[model samples]
Structures are given as structure tokens and as C-alpha cells.
Target: MANTKQAVPDTLPLLRDRIDSIDSQIQALINERAQCAQKVAEVKLAEQGGDAVVFYRPEREAQVLRRVMERNEGPLGNEEMAKIFRQIMSSCLALEKPMRIAFLGPEGTFTQQAALKHFGKSIVSAPMAAIDEVFREVESGAANYGVVPVENSTEGVVNHTLDSFRDSRLKICGEVEVRIHHHLLISPHSNADEVTHIYSHQQSLAQCRAWLDRYWPHAERVAVSSNAEAARLAAEAGKNGRAVAAIAGEVAGEMYGLMTVSANIEDRPDNTTRFLIVGNQEVPASGKDKTSLLISAKNEPGALYHLLEAFERHGVDMTRLETRPSLMSRWGYIFYIDFVGHYQEEGCQAAIAELRDRASEVKVLGSYPVAVL
Candidate 1:
């Protein structure tokens, strides 16, 4: 028994030594991979003429993940393998060219989360005060790409984003959808039962109106500019141990030094928001693509119908359609649409040409790869 116990202790040490050796080997391989990524950056830099060209490709990253999932073995699940490759590609892309992404922020908003999720932590992000400001940043060359909320699955389209597209010439280069989980956050010292008022962005407050009405019947619901800003104010005002909370994310908890009192407070459990990437140049066709356009109808009956009929005739699919009152004329409206297929495809070209002849105005915003979830 004494000999067996001694052997057991020695064997455990040997196993530990083997594990340490394997960990060292893994560290060396990781370093070598990083070096290879830097070399790739050097080659891309030379090809694109110094530092001007944008090298981080969102669509390429999606393709890489899809391929990784397809080739993954059963020992590790597909999602697990894809996540590993996603981070690997993120690191490699950082070395290629650190993307500068702009999102609706004061930070800690769901839009910011979507931007980071889509671009990964490798990107350098800038926060813009307004959704329109995010679009303008990318339009004016201040930001490489801008992420703005386009719509919420439950609450419907964000009118501000649609209105901005009416006049801006920016193109939709990519898209991302993020699941939103709102929390009731308060200062560490504040008691949840003693809360008097709750604050959040106008949209957020509106989204959770039903829930708040049922729960905090007497507490005043206030709207702020953004969720993160609301959280900041809640943390700052909790000095008396009386002021209440803000509806924001757990990530925003540390940002404002607030603690989450209640989690997942949104009306819908599956609430999600879709965001768009706006840029100056139109991306070339990826096999699976979406094209957006702004079309104005002539001052005649059946004008809008005639425009949509072209899609039916060409067999092109219209994914989304929205009408916004045109600023130029009274009672006039512009129709914004998202359609399937690339602009280069024969059917798509035919549809555009037909709409050009049939509509008052038709502007092709651009065709880009379908967004990865």
C-alpha cells in the first residue's frame, strides 16, 4: 500500500509535467500564428498602396466561419469550432488592418454591442451621439464604417435611420443583428424596493412600457438620450440612497458603476435589433447579396404599383419596403426597399432598368453580401 501511494504521487507529478509541456507548445504555436498574420498584413499593405486601403473584410470573415463550421469534426461541435476560428480570424484581421468602426454610443448601448460583435474586439470603435452622426462619420471619411440601428424585430423600423437614408448617398455594406437584454440597474447602495424613478433612452423606455406599467406602477419613467447615459445618471444620482435605476445592459453596469437590480426587463424575451454598416463605396457582388434603393413615385395613380410590378416581372425578391414623406414636395413620399440578388445579375439589372423608366427617381444604394447572424 505504501509503494502504491508513492507511485500515485509520482505519476501525478509526471502528468502535470506533461500538461505544462503541452501548454508551452501551444503558446509557441500561437506566437508563430501571430507572426504569420503580421506577414499577411505586410503583403496586403503593399498591394493596396500603403495605409489608405481598407483590408478588414466583414464578408470574408463570415465565409471563413461558414467554412470552418462545415469542415468541423464531431469531437467538438460546429459552433465551438466556429467560435474558435472566429476569434482566430479576428486576431488575424487586426494584424491585417485594425478596422475603425463607429456606432451609436456614449458606449454600453446595444448598438455598440452589435458593432463589437460584428467587427470583433480587434476594431477601434468611436462613439457618436446620434444615429445620423454615425452615418455622417462614415460618409465624410471620418470613420471607415458606421453601425446604426435599422430596426427592432418587435418594435419595427427605426424611423430615424430610414429618414437619414432619404438624403444620404451612403451604401449599405453590411448588416448585424444583436439580441437586446435590458436590465434594471441601480447604484450599489440603492435598494430595489425603494426605487422611485427609472430612466432610459426614449426607444428603450417605449419598448418596455408595458412591463414597467405592470410592475412599477407609481414610479416615473423618464427618457434620456441613450441607455448608457441613463445608467451614468442613475449611478451619479444615487448618493441619497433614494434615486432609482436605469434600464440598460449588464455590460453597462461597470461602465456606470451600477449594479443590476433586475435583469431581462424588456417586454419581449426574444427582442433583437438589426443594424446596418454604412460606407462610401459600393461593395462588389458576393454570391448571396442584398440591394437597397430609394424610389419616388410619379404624381399619378398606379405609379407605386408600376414600380413594384417590375420586381414581380423580373422575379426579384423585395425583402423590406418603407415609405417616408418626401421633403421636397407636399404629400409626396419616397419608397425605400431592400431586394435580393446582386446588381450585376441579369434579372436585377432588368428590374433596375425597368424601374428607372417607370419611377420618378430610382437610386441604387448598393449591393452587398447578406449579413451573417
Candidate 2:
């Protein structure tokens, strides 16, 4: 090597100067991007003649994140890069309007974490006590968007969230998946060996059942309204020197000043929960998308078959199919079908048209961009 490092030192001072210069450039470019975002707001207002403009378009943001990931040549992975851009987009959007997002929560819940991940920290996250309340919050204009858990890898479908869609006029604008990590947490001052009872949400208790049974079998496992609530209960009990512990996530543990006795105690290492973003506005196609539909099959033999056959005939990829008890008829069933294509697309439209001719009722819940990050 011809003394490759002789000219410039790889010293801290030199690196600091280079990082400072890079930071300045990044700051300048971010401000320029913000200016462009502001101009976008102006253009929309001018074009619509001051009508209500949806500043936060789910499809648009999804497309932007997808592009960011695609172009990333990172030492940092694509998700890490996309997360950086997500915050930038969040800040720029805040210049136009700060979104009020609602989630089934009491702060520190996974649903709240998903909401923040989807909308970024600039949003106003309202904690609703129930799934229906989250839907109502967005529907009543109390919140710009609502996030509710739809299904989990370990537990299965969230029936309450599914049933809410049956009657709500609100549309599914987007979907977010959250990796669930359950921990056996206790207050710092509490004695782990003295733990007498464990608390968590029912689903959480189920997810961590094997682990808890293995290590904490002697402790009484109690199911509460939510893991965050369990954390609070554990903290309260711990302060009084009672033998209580909670099974929750890092968010809850941090919130309650708890220390983890066991980490990632979930039975399934890759346990994840999928949440839906419910909003008033209908999202347009964003290249890669998914469509959700609620249908009532005619009470006849092969009624459901004909409805499903249309999707196959039209070459639409059906992703998920769920059945809920139909209120229209006790013996009847409401079908919740999710497919991999925008409802407005030719194939999806053709399938739906065939479905309308076959089923007693067909309702397009929404067509939204698929999750990118």
C-alpha cells in the first residue's frame, strides 16, 4: 500500500468536523423539504378552492416510504432509513396540520406504539378504552385517525375490531404490524423472589403462557384490561412491598419504572399483531395495495362459493377471509374478505361486480396501500 492513511488522520477531531458538516447539509435539505411540503398544502388549497383538504394521505405517505426503502443503500437497514424519513414526513405534515390519532389504549400499550409508528410522534394520540371507541373517535371527528388491533400471529382474530367494521361507515385507510415482546417486569424496589402474583392482558398471558408456566408457575396469573393497566397495578403493589409482578412490554415497564426479571417471555419469538388504521377518508391506489370488503352471501347452496369463485375467475389474490355472525339473520354470516389489489382496479372491480350479482349484499370497506415499513 502506498502509505494510504499518511495524508489524513482517522482521528476523532477530523471525524467530528466531517460529521458536523454532514449535519449542516442534512439540516438544510430537511428545511428545503419542509418548504416543499408547505407549497403542497398551498397548491391543494388553491386547487380545491378552500374546501376541506386531506393533508395526510395514507397512500401518498406509503408510496414515499416505499421509495425511500427502495433507494436506500444503507449501512443502516431499509427500515431504519424509512423510520428516519417517517419522522421527517411527520414534522413536515405537522406544518400543515397536526393529526389527532386515537388507539385502544391507556398509554404504553402496543396499540399506542403502533399508532406512533404509523403516524409518527408529532400526532396527538388519544387513548380510547375500547375498540368501538377508537372507531367512534375517528367517525365523530374527535380523531383524524384510529388504530385498532385486528389480529395477532399467536392469538388469532380480534373479533371486536372485525365486528366494529360491520356497522361503522369509516374505512380502513392502512395497516400496521407490531412485533410484540412481553417481559416479566417488576418495580425496581420489589423483590423478584418474593413475587406472589403476575398480571397482564388475557392475550398477553396466553402468548407468554408457556414461559410463565415454566418459571413462574407458583405465582397467580391474573388477566386485566390491558398490559399497561397490569404494569400500573404491579407498580402500585410493588411500592407497598407486596409480592406482585406484571407481564408487559418495554413501553409499559418504562412507564411504570419497572425492571425486567425476564425478557421476551412470549411463547412465540416472532409473535406479531396486525392493526388497522381506520379513518373517514377513502384512500386511492398506491401501486401496491389491498382491498377489504364486507359481504352478505345469499342464503342458498353455493352462495358463498359463487362469491369467492369470482375472485379466482378474475385472478385477484385473496389474502384473508373472516366470518362474523350476521345481524341480518341469526343463521346467516357476514364475510370479511381482504385481497391483494385495489378495489378500483379492473380485476377487483370485475370480481366485485360478479359478487354483487351473486351475493345478497356487497360493501367495499376500502382499498389502501399495503404496509411498507
Candidate 3:
């Protein structure tokens, strides 16, 4: 047989030329996509005929990310590949209208990280002191949406988040899960031996309890409002020649210009936190969706059983269930439930209807597309 295979180039110059060509093509295609997004915004404005046009659609973005993952054929992992597309979509959406997002933060917290992960870095992030403030920002139209932590894989539910949902009219439009990795950080001027006080958010402190006991048992643990605040305090203390350190994530450490004394200090390596996106608009069904509900059962015998039986009878899959003290009635509790399927679906609607009949009050918080990236 005649030799027909072409020899692969081993020269660096040839590889560089190929990469440059690919970059040029990628840039051109990205601009083309941006133009299309602009056209979509124009169409939306013309149809709505007002400034109230919704440029960002959570369901559409979720579908796009999911489709990208499904069609990806790569040596790169699904998440890494999806992230590239995420930045592209974020840039294109910015050409339409830059999205403003509020998150629980002092700017370097995990909630802020989740907002960037969900919306992409091409967004205006406003940091609020508390979760309720994040909700209020979205409710008052100061921000297009808000991101707040709902649950931690290690610590269970964030009760304050559930309580905020009890009275807020905002809906859960999307969700993002971030793996939590706490690090012990010290200022550039400080060292491990000089560190006396370890500062972090209460939850973070608890998360790293065992690690602390083993490493710095005698050091005083001080709980602060947020990890970023802890980082700020540590940095400030360093400037003053005080021996202090902070337990925070990489973002906070880098943001405050602190050095990592120890990395991944959390007791549980697999600790992860789930955050929810809250907004004023309702999200349409993205083929894969989840719905959250707030239900207050009658204070009587078998009240909880009656409320749960409806989902079992309808064959709906329940994902999480949490209870919080009711503000309306003393000694009473309200249930927060999350289940698979959109509220618009027949099975979910039937289950919700049955729940309403059995419970004293039922509120469909929102149906949102499942996290894709």
C-alpha cells in the first residue's frame, strides 16, 4: 500500500500559527453571537413597547448551558468546558444589557462567588450585609436579581434564608452549588507562630472546628459577620503589627492581600453550599426543573403527615424538607419543601392542590431550572 498519511508537525511555530488561526475564528464567531443577542433584545423591546423588557431569561440560560454540556465532545471536563461557554454567553448578554446582581457579602464571600458563577463575571455585583438585604435589593428593583445561601451539605439549612422567604414576594429563579473550601489566612507580615486570634464567620468557624483543635487549640476563635470581614480585620491587624489570622476562602484572602497559612482547613473535604437566585419574575419550565413550597399545616394531630401524603400519592419526588418557627402563631411551625418538577406540570399542580386542601396555608415559592454549570 502507498504511504498516504501526512506527518504531524512537531515545530512550535506551526502550533502557534494554528492556535492564532483558531483564536481569530473564535473572536469573529463571538461577535456574531453578540449581534444576535442584541437583535433579541430589540425584538423584546419592540414587542413589549416599554422599558420593562426582560433581557435576561433564567430558563433560556439554563437550557443553553445544559445543551452545551450535552453536546460537548472534549478532552476538557464538562464543567470546565461549560464555563468557557458561560463567559461567552455572559459577554453576549452584556451586549444586550448588563445584569445587576445583589449577593450576601462584603464582596469576597461565597455568595458573591456563586453569583459570579451563575451569572458570569460580566455583571454588576452589589454586596449586602445580610440575606434579607439581598432580597430587599431585588424586591425594590435596585438589582435585577439576588443570590443567597439556602443550605450547606455539612451544616444543614440556613434558617435565616428560609425565614426571609416566608414573607418575601421574590421567587427562586435559579440555583448554584459551590464546593466550600476554607483556608487559614495570615497577613504578609504575620506567621503561624505569631497568630493568636483566629477570625471567621460563625458558620465557617464551626466548619473548621476539628482542624482548629488539632492545629491551634489554644488560639482564641472569634466569630465575625462574614469571612471577608475576617480577612479585612486580619489585614488591618497586620498593618498595625498585631498577630492575627483569618479563616476564609481563597477569594477573600486574595481580595484582602493576605497569605494562606494553611489551605482547605475545613473538617469535611466534601462540604458544599447551595445558593438560590431570587427575582421578581416567574421562570418558565426548563425541561429539568425544581419547585420550592412554603406550607403551614393546621396545628393538629397528623398535620405533617397529611401535608406529605399528597406528594407520595402523586408520585412526586421530594428533595428536601425543613421546618421553621412560624412568626404568625407562637409554638407553631411552617414547612419548607423542595421537590422535582415544575409547578406548571400536571403532576406537580395536582400535588400542590392537594397540599393546599390539607394544609392551613400553602405558597408556591417558585419553580426554577436546575443548575447546569
Candidate 4:
């Protein structure tokens, strides 16, 4: 018996066979699911009478994911299960209709991530270089919808998005809030201790200003088009082994082959950014809805107060009121407002009429379901 080795169980072949069987079953189930999705599309088309509306219902998909997570009882946690369901729903929705979503990008930005989270992995994404370009893409029918950041918990409203709405005819179809986690990334070849310059989008840099001041106080902060773009630039310059890095998402590190030297570098831990979905079509009433409008008030005395009074008398709840200087004319202002109630309701109609009467110009941007997040 002198040191003779025992035979191995050869479980690898058995496991391989089991995997192949499961893959076949999964393939069959996928085909069946796709057929069902086609039926859903047909039903939606019949109900809509060929009206151009996106077939994907994000709220419904979210409900489905919530149910799946609640029922899951496996080695995987609730978040893991929800993630899997999210992708599945994305695929099924794609079968119903593959949506083209335009987002502010060069990928890996929080905006891109939020768009993917809302639209699912099945959507075709176009990364627009500028925010205006994203609005243009949706307006021109080149994309089904556009996703752009409207506000952040830490830094307040994104003024550019508000200004764009002043001229955009696209309606707000939906909204989503994504938790923004900023990270400090450096190329693998770079020495963190020797870093002299940091780069990121201006807003992101601003969001992490306190942290940057506390840590790399002497480093130069260079702003780029986006956080992801800054990551790309840092990775490119790694060949020279310069002391350079960027602040971006952790995923960006993996995408650009960089390393996350620090995580959660934002000044606040509960930083969340709200993004709006813009399209040419209105979203169906989901019971509770919020409508956004752009009102241009005359510079006359009491013009603003009168507009606010109209909503008060109509029993409508106003969520936000922001003022922007009118670009076309001097001594004029544009008021962006968010209010409760659907545009189709009687109270909402009365409020809108009153608002128009008081304001020099009033534009109803869109009414869409309130995002629970």
C-alpha cells in the first residue's frame, strides 16, 4: 500500500453535464418568455391603438423586482436576487420594445449607471458628449428617451437641466434617484504617494471638495467633461507614470484598469442625484403624479406672488420653485415648478389656467408618476 494515491471522484464531468442540462432548460425557458413578451406587446398595441408609447413600465418592473427580492431565500442576499431580476426584466422589456436611451456620457458616469438601472441592460444606449446633445437626441427622435441629472442632495439642483427645459418640448416621462458614490482612482502604474494632480467633472470635484481639501490639499484639481472621462484620461497618462489620478466610480477603475485608492470620497455619505427621463410622449397616469412647468413671469411688481397664490387657492401642492434669468430678454425670469396632481385632473387644469393668466409665458413640461425612491 506504500503511499499509493486514491482515485479522484471525477466530479468535474458530472458538474459539467449538470450545467449543460440547466443551460438547455434555461434556453427553452428564455424562448418561452420571449414569446410571452411578444404577446404583451400585441396587447399593449391593441389597448393603445397604435399610439407611440414606450412599452416598458419601470414602476411595474420595480414592483416585480421587489417581490422577487422579498421571496428570495437562497445563499444570495436580497440585493443580489433583485439585481438578477432587474436584468431579467430588462431582457423581457427589450423583447417588448428595445428602447434607445441617450445619457450624458462617455460611460461609467453615475448618469449612465442610472439610465441603465431605469431602462435595464437590454436598452440601446447612446452617450452624448454634452447635456444639450442628450436633449437634442430625444427631441429629434434619434432616441426614445433621454436621462439627465436634475438635482443632487449634496449640491442642490442642476441649473443647466432646468434652463434646457425652458426651450425643450420633450415631456418628463419619469424620474429616478441614484446614490452617487465617488471614489479616488489612480492608474496601477502610478504611485499614490506621489500624486500631484486630481481630475474629475467640476460638479463631482465640488461634491468632494471637503475631502480633497482634507487629504490632497496641495494637489491641483483639474476639471474634465465627466468623471468617467477623467478616469479615462488618467489611465491614458499612466504610461508616463505621472503622479495623476481621478475621482470617479469604483466601476470606472475596473473599466479603465485603474485602482480605487479611496472610496466614498464625497463630502456627504447620503449623496443622491435625481435624474429625469425626457421624451416626446407623456407617461400614463400612475395614480400619483407630479407635473413640472416653466413659467416666465413679468418683472412687474407682485407677478411672482400672484403665481404662487393661484396654486394655493387651487389646493395644489408645489414641491419646487426655482428662478432662472431669461436668456432671450433682460429683466425677465423663468420659474421652474414641480407640483402634485395629474395634468388631466380638474384641479390641475384650473391651476394651470390661473398660472398662465398671471405669468407672461407658461409651458407645461410634463406630468409623470412620482418616483418612489
Q: What is the TM-score of each candidate against the true structure?
A: 0.88, 0.95, 0.96, 0.85
Q: Best-fitting candidate, measured by TM-score?
A: 3
lDDT of 1: 0.83
Per-residue accuracy of model 4 over 78-143 as CA lDDT, tens digit each: 878777667777788888888899999988888998898777689898999988999999999899
Worst 10 residues of 2 by lDDT: 1-10
- What's the CA error at residue 159 for candidate 1, in Å? 1.7
Which pairs clash in the backbone of model 1? Answer: none
Q: What lDDT score is found at residue 296 in candidate 2? A: 91
Greater-lDDT candidate between 1 and 2: 2
lDDT accuracy of residue 198 in candidate 4 = 98
The residue-level lDDT of candidate 4 at 195 comes to 91
Q: CA lDDT of each candidate?
A: 0.83, 0.91, 0.91, 0.85
**What are the per-residue Cα lDDT tens digits for candidate 2 across 1-373?**
2332235548999877766766887899899999999999898888765537888999999999999999988789999999999999999999988899999999999999999889888998799999999999888998999999999999989999999987899999999999999999998878999998999999999999899888988999999989999999999998887868999999999999999999999999999999999998889999999999999988888878888899999999999999988988878989999999998899899999999998888999999989887
The candidate, 1 or 3, that scores higher on lDDT is 3
Q: Please, what are the lDDT tens digits per residue for candidate 1 over residues 219-317?
A: 998889899999988988787657778998877777989987778889998899988888876677667788888898787888888989999999999
Is 1 or 2 the stronger prediction by TM-score?
2
- Model 4's lDDT to the true fold? 0.85
Which should have the higher TM-score, number 3 or number 4?
A: 3
Task: Assess candidate 2 and give its lDDT.
Answer: 0.91
